[model samples]
Target: MSNTAGRIEPAITDIEQLKDHPAMARLLSWKRDAITEAKFDRDELTITIDRAFIRDACNILKPEFNFLSDVTSVDWLPSEPRFQVTYHLLSHKLKERVRLRVMLPGGQPTVESIISVWPAANFFEREIHDLMGIRFIGHPNMTRILMPDDWEGHPLRKDYPVEGYR
Candidate 1:
């Protein structure tokens, strides 16, 4: 591969500009409505998938992103869609990585579980549920993995008390 050793490209946020990206191309071709947003920043591709189509999107991209690197969540407090669940996928054959995200409303932070696509997601999803309070529908076992069964609230949530919950 030819390399421009010193060249640094600017981030691309426009869908048109990212259409040529492998992950973006595949997802857009499969279901345009599934992708809400996309970005290629610092050599990393992040695709924001609509909550309704997250599972489908994962299934579609599974062939290309054959390895699920991680599954995690971010709490965007005071925001209407207060949570972002992110899945990091790796393609060993392509030697590439991509991130898929799903935004969930604060009132009901729920998303379809991708455990069906990648069984390794079991522990990761359970951890997110235990600490962030985001539920994974269809997860074989959704019980807390990091927190106690009787834990009062999700510890990692932005609204959770700084000190231990009383």
Candidate 2:
């Protein structure tokens, strides 16, 4: 978390520079088939993809992004796909980072696990599965990491009671 070493030299300082990169070209090719939306702010890129294609996207991006910084989820109660699971990735060599997002229906929201793509996703996926009730299919061990196994409902859901569960 601390960049105390010094200002890290940025790779691909201008987002525009990504246009010609092979990895970027491959990623963009899926824009219509897999990617739903893409947004860039400051120097970071956030792309929304169909949950079914997450693995393919990660594979395409693996050459440029070698690190998975974090995986988390957001619950949007009234939204069509009520859960938005996000993956944060960092490229040490490229010195760049990007975010990938997938939306799932509120009813038993589920998506494939990325642990196969990045082993580090184990704990993070478990955490999201625990707190958000967003199942990660194909996860090696999908047990709850935070809440008790017997807990009634996901605590991070927008509808969860603010009061402590009795």
Candidate 3:
């Protein structure tokens, strides 16, 4: 399908084809410096971008990947960048799904919200914020969705006790 620039971009069907797609090329071009690593494993293509460039990278992919299926965070405690905020996107026409990840520093634990790109991301962002304590900057309503307002710490964090931190 055609991208916003009106240029015909490759219709990516799988992770292997993604590497050659013009759309993927454009995305890599913009985040070449920000990207620390990328991998296509288990039939999913995952690209990890610096947390600071999350908004820009997501915007580039938004044109082709119209569906934001999920937004979640993985806590890698005892690590420098302790959290990984992942975006799961789908392209109906291409019948492909890919993941975008942004590694947020444990000290700050924040990243730009993609709600603007996909309004449906509002709820998913909230969930990530609530459970992982990863702030989503610019989220219309950045409040706890699955936990009480007075919750002490993010439940999903590795440091959080198994029985709940009391």
Best by lDDT: 1
Q: Each candidate: what lDDT? A: 0.91, 0.82, 0.80
Whole-model lDDT, model 1: 0.91
List residue ranges in candidate 2 displaced over 4 A: 1-23, 30-32
Regarding lDDT, does 1 or 3 come out ahead? 1
lDDT of 1 at 30: 96
* lDDT string, candidate 1, 1-166, tens digits: 5476676788788999889878898998999988899988888999999999988998998998899999999999998789999999999988999999999999868999989899999999999999999999999899998777997888898888888766
Model 2 lDDT per residue over 44-130, tens place: 677788889998799888877989999999988897878999999888997878888998998978899888899999999999988
TM-score of every model?
0.91, 0.83, 0.83
lDDT of 2 at 55: 81
Candidate order by TM-score, decreasing, is 1, 3, 2
Candidate 3 matches the true fold with a TM-score of 0.83
lDDT of 2: 0.82
Candidate 2's TM-score: 0.83
Error of 3 at 143 (Å): 0.9
